[model samples]
Target: MSAKRVDSTIVVVAVAAAIVGAVALLGVLGQAWMGYAPSHLLTYLPMILLPIAFALVAVALVRAALRRRQTEVGQS
Candidate 1:
């Protein structure tokens, strides 16, 4: 488990989670807008999860970027 492998896994998982969250959110919102009550659950669940998912993705990206910068500096 090298640092690079761990980081790559994190990034992949975060991105996939974020995408799933976004899709769920959109589906719920769309259904609700069309006057479906059951979609409320979908809307709320994804609304909560979406932000967390996005935050995870953002953190992963920032970490990767910082690591790249550090490596570049070390090489120079």
Candidate 2:
């Protein structure tokens, strides 16, 4: 991939990550507002999802960075 393509992919991934994070946060808040009682299983649902989402985002960002580096090196 070219530098331009890599940069665009990074931007798109970042935007997607932000959207997913927002939706996950909203879901957690909504559940709380609905008076759902905290339990061993119920309490950790949001926390679990949040980390998984973040990890996925991190992976995408790293992949983009690596691709950009590879393209740059290849052009030299």
Candidate 3:
């Protein structure tokens, strides 16, 4: 996939989805803690990708932030 170009818009969507999925998973986990049905947790299993997606977005963001900071430091 790196051999071809990917759209920036898609990456943004993935990052958004990743964040929502992670929050939903956390909510489901909270429900389990409150003595809700164990089956409810099963529904959230598919959200595991959120953490991975979140990590990807996080890395990219961190890199960008550091680069910007480095530029500012160099200029000053």
lDDT of the structure predicted as candidate 2:
0.64
In the range 41-60, model 2's lDDT, one tens digit per residue, is 44455466556657766866
- TM-score per candidate: 0.67, 0.50, 0.45
Candidate 3 residue-wise lDDT, 29-59, digit = tens: 7778999864544456535667667676776
Candidate 2: Cα lDDT at 14: 58
User: lDDT score of model 3?
Assistant: 0.63
lDDT of 2 at 20: 64
| Whole-structure CA lDDT of model 1 | 0.76
lDDT of 1 by residue, 1-76 (tens): 9987887887777777778778887887787788886466676767777677778778878988888877755543
What range of 10 consecutive residues in model 3 has the weakest lDDT sum? 1-10
Candidate 2: clashing pairs of residues: none
Q: Relative to the true structure, how large is the alpha-carbon lDDT of every model?
A: 0.76, 0.64, 0.63
Residue 46 CA error for candidate 3 (Å)? Answer: 4.2
Q: Residue 40 in model 3: shift from native, Å?
A: 4.7
TM-score of 2: 0.50
Candidate with the larger TM-score of 1 and 3: 1
